[model samples]
Target: MNVLLQVADTAGAACVFLGAAICLLGVVGMLKLPDVLSRSHAATKPQSLGLLVVLAGVALRLHSVMDLATLALIGFFQLLTGPVASHLVARSAYRTGQVERGDLLFDDLDAQLTEPGQEEGQGRRDSP
Candidate 1:
């Protein structure tokens, strides 16, 4: 029983550590990515999943039912919210022309961000 408990503890710790590392990787990727949309994708996908895995590891390590329930709730909420938030942000960025889509690759949002007066649609960020 003791050995089994130790193994469980080790596994949980490993999961948590690995999840954190994955999150850091996502952050690094976001920083290293060339464009805003790409960075947002890095942030919204791998990092969100990494958070979920970390929460699961915490849930595994928790001894109390309440703690487990809380962790599960957090995980559920994150899973539900993360993608929606990402989509909204990405859409807003595309709408506002904040993302750069230059290069000779396939593009879809090209028309949305580029028009005669569309550049001004982003408005003044200097406004108080």
Candidate 2:
């Protein structure tokens, strides 16, 4: 029992350290990336992964059910919001002409935006 507890503690500490390192790399990527789209990608993907890892480490260390539940909730919200926020940032950058159209391999948004008979902002209207 003592040996198992020690192993769990060591693994939890390693996970927390590794997660922090991953998050640091993501910040570096965000700073080094040249464009808004790439930067947003850097901002979300690694950060989300790192956060989940950190939460898992916390869960391992915490014996309380409530603490584990709270960690799970935090991880859920991070997974839910991170990519959505990144997508919104990238979409706005593309709309505002910050992203270079020529750089994109598949321009689906361009097709939607330029569809014939659709006025500017008309295709995106939420309500009739």
Best by lDDT: 2
Positional deviation of residue 31's Cα in model 2 after best superposition, in angstroms: 0.2
User: Which regions of candidate 1 fall more than 4 Å away from where they truly are?
Assistant: 101-128
Where's the lowest-lDDT run of ten residues in candidate 2? 119-128
Query: Which lDDT tens digits does candidate 1 get at residues 20-124?
Result: 998999999888998767877898888878998898778667789999889888888888988898888887886667866565276665664464554745643
Highest TM-score: give the candidate number. 2
Per-residue CA lDDT of model 2 for 16-111, tens digit only, reads 999999999999999999999999999999999999898888777888999999999999999999999999999989888999999999999998
lDDT, candidates in the order shown? 0.79, 0.90
TM-score of 2: 0.93
